[model samples]
Target chain A: MTFFEAENVSKNYAGHTALDHVSINVKEQSIFGLLGPNGAGKTTLIRIINQIIGPDTGELRIKGEKLNPDHIAQIGYLPEERGLYKKMKVGEQAMYLARLKGLSKQDAYSRLKKWFEKFEIENWWGKKVEELSKGMAQKVQFIVTVVHEPSLLIFDEPFSGFDPINAELLKQEILKLKDKGATIIFSTHNMSSVEELCDNIALIDKAKVILDGEMQSIKQEYKSNAYELKVRDLQKDINEILPSSFNLKKIRALNNCQSFVVELPGNVTSNELLSQVMPHAQVSSFEEILPTMNEIFIRKVTEAGRSK
Target chain B: MNKIFTILRREYLSRVKKKSFIIMTVLGPILMAALFVVPVYLANVSDREMKVAVLDETGLFYDAFHNSDKVEYENIYMDYATARDQFEELDYDALLHIPESALNNPNSVKLLSTSNIGLNMISDMESVIQKKLEAHRLSLSGIDKKVLEDIEVDVTINTFIYKEGEEKQNYSEISYALGLISGLLIYIFIFLYGAQVMRGVIEEKTSRIVEVIVSSVKPFQLMMGKIVGIALVGLTQFVLWVILTGLIVFTFQTINPDLFKYKSPEQQMIENKGLTPDELAVQQENLELSNDKANSLLEGIRQIQFGNILIMFLFYFIGGYLLYASLFAAIGSAVDNETDTQQFMLPVTIPLILAIISMQVVLNNPDGPVAFWMSIIPFTSPIIMMARIPFNPPVAYWEIGLSLAMLVAGFVFTTWLAARIYRTGILMYGKKASFRELFKWIRF
Candidate 1:
């Protein structure tokens, strides 16, 4: 079931359109990546979903019901510019934010205690946020965003200030949240993480969604039907042996091994290309090259830009 | 509603728990009480007796210089040079030289002292010499000095204010002081607490916590919560100040009751006397003629309606603060930092500053056109009305009712405007907002 959806949502600020007739749907218990460049309407769309802003012309639904203030309790948002009261104690600030999200005081305290312990940060609860390092404060803010166990969690650029280890830890935590049946909308410029974590993604560019689908299918749709072949025989000429249906893109020699990249025509399958190249050389390895999410993001955004 | 409470609780608790807030709350009343009591204590404690030597070469004013509680005068029989040399030996604070120019050119009288002589001593000596010279000239002109003294007449006016079919004595001095104080207190409370609200908003905005809070609660709720929370802090401080100031003033008064005593010596003497009815009546009349000045001042203080002033003072204080603080909050949200707030602050503070500047005019003519218009206008009425209320002016009930209604309306309008500016401005950064931009936010 679609846990959250925005139908033809548009937002205008001053004379500029921030979001122009954008629609997105997130499946239950899945991580939906919102990919966009700087100045795109990704943040605006996320804000609309959180109801921090109202769309100029559209409606939002949560759990197949019309959105209202009551839905705020079920949504948690961590904005791109992360913030916390610098002079406030960590535990108290967390509890206050959780209560603001509609959790009981006792429940907030108990849940925060567990989260703090799980993160091994129980000792820092009494410290002021200003005294904490940027990464530490980000962790505290991350804890605050999910402490209430909202059904839909929106994190904008959640991994920007984190180190590699902390980013891995956060990735684990996000996966754990998804396992616990929370629908997540993650927005970032980092595409590698989207490949690792996102089940589905919608690429927004220039206030419009240019590409969106399940992560596997979007990468598959952008693939060039290319394959990397490692052959031991350096004596065979790859250009002459390849059929007219296939184009040999490159042939490189590494030590005693020769590897060639071959692209198949649209009508040709990967198996056909593999079989066609097998007799030309001693094919030790044959692997189809699928495009990375990063390649797909860059290619699609540039293509959209060029088209416009 | 619950989210607003959460924000309110956070704002109040974080501020009230600050060490600075506690220190100010405790220190404010002590400083205020000291302002009232210290000057009185200093005046009483610094009264030391001074001694003067009078070298009268003319010998015409030997007995004119009399001793009082604050000064002692002794006549010296010596030349000017001998008197000057003996002045230090005599330990005199000053030496008064009455040069003989055939008792003419009174302005040429010289007073020499080792150090600066007190103005009180100089005036006293001048008056003594003038009185004796006047009597001397009167006798030489063939007119009896007693006839000139008998022609002297003292005039006094007793003021009564007739209101609601009753005669109420009016005390302009006491009421003026109370009016000035009430008006000044409201001015101070509004400025002090309004800036506090502005500073609180700036802190939250600059810290970037506003977006976090606004996401959970509406921007309007967050602004209202902060405004109300700081107002409660102001009220808490004020209540503490009133109680502490009262306690301090009461303790000081109880410890030094004589410090505030306004009784004249003649009244004290009459109370101690026992006389026949005929003598008593004559003495009583003389006492009234001699000491009515002191009694009239005390009576004037007794005639003021303190209870009425207190009630109106509190009402205007809260109303004025609410009206100004909302505007201050709006200015705070429109800026990136404190320095950027100057342009917005001037417009918001001008009306309050104008109210204070016109307080004196309102106090003088509580029923005049300026006072009437100022007291009727919502922006100025908080202070001007408090000033006028103490004077027992013939202000109609509906004027006050209308003024209060307008003040509430003003607060509501400003709060609505502030919320609009705050919602958009909180998320904006690194831009100096113009009035045009602020108005745009209001439209948005």
Candidate 2:
């Protein structure tokens, strides 16, 4: 079921358009990756979801109801430029934010204590935020973001300041939250993390969503017709044996096998290419090469720029 | 509303908990009390009796100088040269000399001290000599001293104002003081708490915490909560100052009852000395008249409709603060740091500064056109109208009501405009803010 939906949302600042007809749907218990380059209107869309700014045109619905102020209690937002009151104590600041999210003082305190204990930084509760190291502050911020147990949590560049170990720890925590049936809108430029955790994504460029769908399906759709083949004991050159429809892109010789990268033209099947190469050399292994999210992002953004 | 309260609580608690806030709250009244007590104490401690020796060569002013708490005079029989040589043995502060030609050369009389002669001592000598000279001339013209005394006249004007066909006593001096004080007070309050609102906004923006905050609550709520929170802080400080200053002054009065009294017993004693029955009767009547003036002043103050002035004061106080604070918050939002706020600060502060600068004009001519228009214009009304409240023939009901209504509308309009600018300005970063850019944000 769709947990949050922004339909045809558009926003303009002064005379400049920040977002135009931008829309994204986040499903319950799924992680939605909001992918975009800087100033691509992704932040604007997230802000609209958070209700920090209203869309000039279009509507937002959460769980089949029109989004309103009460829904703010159910949504937690960790902005890209995240910060805590530096002069305030760690636990006090967390309690304050959690209370702002509609948690009672007692509940905020207990939940904050639990999060602080789990993060193994319970001693930091009394320490001011300015006293914490950058990594430590990031961990505290992550805990604060999720402490209210909000049904929908939005984290923008959540792992920007984390070290590898803490980043992995945060990833596990986010996955655990999703397991507990929370909807997540994850916005970042880190495509590797998107590939690892996102179930669906929308890539926005220049105020428009250029690409969006289920992660795997979108990756599948973006894959070119290319395959990597390993063959050994060849009787003839593989390139000479293949028809002109199969373009051999690169060849690399290993100790026991020769690797061939072949691009198949339209209407050409992998089976046909395998069969054509099999007669000339024994095919040890064959695999289709799908595009990485990074490659797809670069390609789509570049294409959008050129078209513009 | 609950969210705004939450934000207000945080804003208020965070600041009130600061060490600086606590220190200032305690120190403010002590400093104010010191401003009063220090000068009085210094004056009392430094006042010393100076003794002057008069050497009158004309020998016509032997009894002219009178002894008082501040100065004493003694007639000397020695000549000027002998007195100058005997000054060390005489142990007197100064030696006065009069040449025989001093009858025509009035400036020939000289006072010489080993150290610098105080101007007070010189004035005392000149006045005594002048009084004696006048008496001598009056005698030469065959004029009686009693006649000269009877010819002196003193007149005082008693002012009254007719309000609603009833005659009421009016004290223009008291009204002038009251108006200036209340007007200046409002000006101080608006600036003190308004800048606090601006600094609070700038802190949130520079620290990057505004985004995190606005996500949960509306920007308008945050801005208002902060402004109201700081206003509460200012009120708290002012109340504490009033209470503490009162306590301090009261304690000092109790310890030394004569600290604030204007007249000393010695002065009364000197005035009563050598007064004939008829002269004493006139003096007693004059004293009673002065006492009646004081009583009338008190009665006038009691009848000045302080209730109306107080109600209007509170209305303008809140109205004026809200208007300026919202604008300050908007300016803070548009700037990245305190330094960048300068360009925007001037325009917002100009109206308040103008109101303060024009207070003199209002006080000088409270019923004039300049005062009337200034009191009606919302930008300057908080101060100008407050100053006109205690004046003669009082500010009209419709004028007060109209000014107040306009103030409410003005604040509402500025708040709406400021909220627009603040919402957009907080989200914009790293850009120098200008009036044109702020205008753009207002449109946004």
Candidate 3:
């Protein structure tokens, strides 16, 4: 059974629909990426799940039970709008927030110590939050959100303000938490991060989910008739030998070496094209390259825009 | 384990550690006491010395305005033009010219000074003129001046009470004083602490911390936690301040006993003016009677069944603070920002101000409908009732019980309203919300 499921959720904020009959399932121990561009109801959906705002009509089931107060204790949420007591000390503020999440003082302190040490921020305990750098404060915020070790974690742009090294470090911790059987819901526009970490992906656009499935399957579903082929330039121009049935999408050449994304007829295979083109140039490498997540994201959003 | 208690502890500790809280708490009472006492202390020592040139054309007030340390009169015959010419050079503070036959026309006399003269100086001259004029009347009458001085009235203040048995005196003066102090303190603490709650909410809301905390705890818990925390902070500071102020005042009095001395010869003369041995004796007898009456009135109040007004003061103080603090929190949360807060602040603040204004009236006449209603109103009662409790309250125990219950009920209801608004307002960004939207949010 799914750890969390929302069935036919709908919400309207002052007659403007933010979520229109949205539904999704989050399996336990899975990294489910809620992907969308700016203003795409991704945050609206996340807020509904966290119960920060109520859905107009829906049933939000957590661990096969209706979502309520007790479910909040098992879920940790890091809001996109980062907030902390600017005047309070780092550890003091963290402890207060941790307690609010239902962690006892002893348990919170013990967990904070480990998280702080692991994040190499143990020395930051005495520093006031306002005195810390943005990245440093983000680390503290990250610690507070996860200190209680909730079973379900929702992070909205959690890697924002984090440098690449720190972002990678956070990614490892998130994956480790998943390995320990925590269901994680991550929302971001960074398709690379989603591609690196997510097992399942849901793309939301204009208050509706346009696509939702396993990450690999969704990527396959959104593929275009494109491939990347790298070749040695034996013949000066490889395009001269290509049949009129083939469509050359793009080509790049440097230092007597060339690479291209080719669109072939549906009846033709890569071997047939390679056999025909081999005599024109000594092929260095030939393989079908799938589109990057960034390309797929832009394509799908543009497609949705055109459809509307 | 106890969530509310946990919130309270955190708030208490955090606020107590702040430097602003520490400074204000410890020094606030001393500063307040100084504001009251310093002026009184200064009034006694501040200059009674004002140099004056008296032109006594009538020759009647030469000795009327006798030389004293407070007013040193120097005789001068300079005309108006000459007095003006040497006004600054003559080293005179003021020139008092009583025109001829001024008693027949008191308005004809004029004072010339480089700047505005003190009212006391002008009033002193009038008083001396009136006494001399009255003395002239006595001389024309059959009685001599000495005989006229001996004629005095001895009035006694008596008290009659309708208690369980006999007619007992009431210590109305001390009771009024005690009542005023308790009531005023409650008024001040409620205002100070309630405003502190307002500022605390604004601070959190401005800092955006409310948004994050609201997601975890219910908005009601967050608002209650802040209200209770700030009250504890106020209470903690109040205790520290009481101790510190007492110590500072005790030290000042002990180390500088001369500062309090009012035994100077001028002070003695001022105390003993216009009285003979017989008149003095009569005055003393009347004073003793009034003092006895005052003391007995005090004893009557002390003997009444209420255990201690101080305890009631504390209960009503906490109750009043909680009641007002919640209202302040509600107002604080209603607006997303401070500027918008003003639109709602008036209605929230007027009740507190009214409670203070009505507190004395309640003390003077506790059994009156005004006091009874103010005490039971829940808004004014915390202060009004506390003030009147020192005075004899003619009411059943149920009134007190009912007032307390209503205060609790009022707090619970208002807290829910504040929490509902807070939950919606905290996360709302950018757009401004109206009263209609906020009221609608409560329905959700």
- lDDT for model 3, on a 0 to 1 scale? 0.78
Candidate 1 displacement at residue B9 in angstroms: 2.6
Q: Which residue segments of model 3 deviate by more than 4 Å?
A: A1-3, A10-17, A48-73, A232-245, A265-268, A305-308, B32-137, B140-142, B146-187, B241-309, B334-336, B353-375, B383-398
The C-alpha lDDT values of all candidates are: 0.84, 0.87, 0.78
Off by over 4 Å in 1: A236-253, A275-280, B46-48, B86-94, B105-117, B142-144, B153-156, B263-291
Best by TM-score: 1
DockQ scores of the candidates: 0.67, 0.70, 0.45
Residues A1-308, candidate 2, lDDT per residue (tens digit)? 99999899999877778888987888999999999999999889988899999899999999989999999888888888877788999888888888888888999998888888899999998999999998998888788788888899999999999989999999999999999999999999999999999999999999999999999998889888999999999998675898887788899999988999998996888999988888788899999999999999999999999997
Q: Deviation in angstroms for A92 in model 1?
A: 2.7
| Candidate 2 ranges with C-alpha deviation above 4 Å | A229-260, A267-286, B38-46, B98-102, B114-122, B137-147, B264-266, B269-311, B432-444
What is the lDDT for A23 in model 2? 78
Best by lDDT: 2
lDDT of 1 by residue, B277-348 (tens): 664565577787766666777777676667777778778888888888888888888888889888898888
lDDT of 1: 0.84
Interface RMSD of each: 1.2, 1.0, 1.9
TM-score of chain A of 3: 0.95
- Residue pairs clashing, model 2: none
Q: Judged by lDDT relative to the true structure, which candidate is superior, 1 or 2?
A: 2
Worst 10 residues of 1 chain A by lDDT: A233-242
lDDT pick, better of 2 and 3: 2
